[model samples]
Target chain A: METIAHKAKLSKSSPVVRKYRALIHHQQDMPVQPDISVKHLNKVYADGFRALKDINLDIEPGEIFALLGPNGAGKTTLISIICGIVNLTDGEVKAAGFDIIRDYRKARESIGLVPQELNTDSFETVWDAVSFSRGLFGKPPAPDHIEKVLKDLSLWDKRNNRIMSLSGGMKRRVMIAKALSHEPRILFLDEPTAGVDVELRRDMWEMVRKLRENGVTIILTTHYIEEAEEMADRIGVIRHGEIILVEDKSRLMSKLGKKELRLHLQSPLEKMPGQLALEPIELSEDGYELIYTFDSQQEQAGVARLLRTLGDLGIEYRDIQTRESSLEEIFVGLVNE
Target chain B: MNLYGVRAIYKFEMARMRRTLMQSVASPVISTSLYFVVFGSAIGSRMGDIDNISYGAYIIPGLVMLSLLMQSISNASFGIYMPKFSGTIYEVLSAPVSYVEVVLGYVGAAATKSVILGVIILITARLFVDYDVLHPFWMFAFLVLTAITFSLFGFIIGIWADGFEKLQIVPLMIVTPLVFLGGTFYSIDMLPEVWQTISLFNPVVYLISGFRWAFYGVSDVHVGISVGMTLMFLTACMIAVWWIFKTGYRLRS
Candidate 1:
């Protein structure tokens, strides 16, 4: 166990070593292999709540796919359907080329899920929990593989500790370890870093990047849109039980994303006379602030024209500031619209 | 369904049960001993012989069935309920552990627990009465059937129950009351014609009566009918539990 842990520690962040890792099989020979595919998927709970509606998606092998949406936007329902946890009321799902409903065992065996909830048996040791998860997938016992998973998640020293004994961050790592125990080709992380600290979050980011390099297809969901921006290769936005937009990260930022331009006057402003509002700049209720929202895709924000209009009005500004649109802002704006 | 996954679930469940050793094995032994002390001596004396057999001997099958019923109900119900309660059901549901494996693992453990408790009670009864096995096969058959039926029923209760309070509703309210009034203390033959007919509606009486017929070779109901009743109940429960799993009735949602 120690030797395996040592090897894992030595090669964790090295992408070359990760790419050649034996158990991290990405299976590059199949060019058209989709890690998971969903077709017009729909789910309605017993109580008649439609949680998912006509969802169709294809996640390619070895890519980081992020599913983003507000609460009740069918993020968990979608992942659950793909993982074969929740049965769909309508449509079909396939995981690693097997139909989820018809070939459930085969489909589920290839995928691993890190659920949103912080769920672990408090009485069980970390080793037992991860091992039990592997056994659940009908995998034969592989202690070395388990050790490597634990070390990769930085959970080697905590292996003998009870789950309740670990801190929130360590417990989160344990969840990832449990999910990866069976050496699945695809791993789904549903809000994996919800309650962890900054360092642990960075550590998880590195681990995920390493996992990706090793050819594992990763699907993650999070309210923290920034994590998606940092880790995801392609972005999908879900709203009200339907996938609204899916685009490349850079393309989405340039296409639908916007930046905020705020000119903070060094001198406090008096009341905005009704005439000053005609330039598309809104005054705060307090009458001391000016706000401008501009699209980044545009060649120019027409800042010169606005300033020329301001100068003609004889409004002297002491300072100006511009804030670019982040993934968080674009996400919130998309959902609202 | 893969049997290895079933076995894994069984091992995990049994380990959990063993962790609370007192609840599964010891508690039943202790409680059955107390029943023999109070009911066998205190109540059996006044009740006199039942159908040419001592009152102590007559209620033996009923008492054994009582523990069997309770244990089976709790074993399956608590097994599944704990997962749902602790949010570990997410791991279970997400895993390759199919509903068939889940039902078999949970119901199998429940049946195992019931059989264990039944044997313990029978061994303990040796100190109190002179009981002999007339037909060991019949006794074994009834024991297995009763265990499976109640365990399947318990599996249903586990699935239907919403929370902690919901888990107790069937065991405390329906199952226990039926076991007590199911001729455990008195044979239905001693009852008035109207009461005897009413007792027929209590399905538990059939289970206890069937078990008594296995042991003593005499019954208020025909042995063939008792066996048939056992088969009928076992079949019904199996189908119902299978359907619940197939549709993912309460579990999937």
Candidate 2:
């Protein structure tokens, strides 16, 4: 009921709803529409395996959204459906206000997809591949735009090089250049950094930020929690073919984040105190330290109580510090449940 | 009809062919020349003539048609199958191009390559033996019609095939054997009446006979029947391609 209520409120302000209201009010103002909207989307493959279930997502213009999921969590399936590459079994998708099914050409024209695979035209020069991709979208030749894309990807030096001879990182960049060649309003990157080296990953993240700055809405799916932590404005987690949670990146971290209290003991003990054993506290190996875990959302009153109890039990700590849980931990916990 | 999309895909496929020039153009041309040398010049001379035409000139249309059929199918099937194998087809699928544009791009390029090969084979045959084209315009028409028809057939094969070996199965086992037995080397009239009757059922027989007719004004089947049959086969292949795209068979998941 709560979920329904939340969505109801959201729809009232949603791009579709706003557009409806604008039409009713005869307002000349063109409200900024969602870059992409997926409603109650479900996918069941021919083999009787369900890949996505009741997914609803709305990406605002220019927002960088990150989709995090474990393997087989339908991240690619969701992206594929929106890109018009995979047909949806149920529900509807709209990209830049065009229905993905009914207005497929228009919808696809507004979107770009950089797939996980490093598939390229091995015999063509980098310039031709990107130019041809833009042409495939029915866009007129814009050599300047192609040159800019190649330059932005640091591929200007190798523009004339055959795709087969470029390094793996460069090949991936060429894919990005191709995806961006048509100057799509929405971009979907499926595991863009998967298997990429650290330097290239950093470069790609920087490029994604720049693209967002230029008003391109970017949605990338990755298993790397840190990538989401560093990039996403909003983060969504998917598990077992279901989207379990979606929240502001900071909000999700703070809501489920835990702070660990670690103590270094002056004197070693063989076992944890019985009074503290039931209090979510554990004695470390060699009995030199004790650790306590608690929700960061809660007050620190429990910490003072734990300290007082330690004093009463004649347990002394040399030093203590608290560390908030990282997004990786929170992600693992969410999927594990 | 997204001409730009068609042009892009067509140019891409053509570029790939240029990169593998030896295999795509040279090999087919060289092999056809060998057939002319062995079958037309050497062995054909001993067999004399068929239908008042020298044996070498008699086999010119047959040999050209044989390569055109095989090359058209092989080029198109391989062109599409490679993208599928390399997983690059997703880009094409995700683009704004419709299925018709995709077919036009691929099949058009394949047909163009086959026609070029047919022309080369015809010129190469002249170097070995003298042959006269009775109807020049009709000869060009038959060349293009056959190339386009077989290229569409090859596009279907590409979609149906999943493996590298499967890509070759139809062109090698089915198409080549049909051409060989479809009276490419000898006129079906030379066989027993029963054998000739059986040969009439082969589709390749109509293609070769029609092409042979364009060259010498002599054919086993009527010119009208050959054109009708080619159009019918082309329509069937086009329908199969349409169904493949509509159903997203072997393409979408």
Q: Pick the lDDT winner.
A: 2
Per-residue accuracy of model 2 over B67-138 as CA lDDT, tens digit each: 999999999999899989999999899998999999999999999999888898888888998999999999
- Candidate 2: pairs in clash: none
Predicted candidate 2 versus true structure: per-residue lDDT over A8-50, tens digit per residue: 1122333433444454346646554667888889999999999
Off by over 4 Å in 1: A1-31, A46-48, A258-323, B41-47
What TM-score does each of the candidates earn? 0.85, 0.93
User: What's model 2's interface RMSD, roughly to a tenth of an angstrom?
Assistant: 0.8
lDDT of 2 at B35: 90
Question: What are the lDDT figures for the candidates, one per model?
Answer: 0.80, 0.87
| Runs of candidate 2 exceeding 4 Å displacement | A1-32, A265-278, A304-318
DockQ of each: 0.50, 0.81
Residue A219: error of model 2 in Å?
A: 1.2
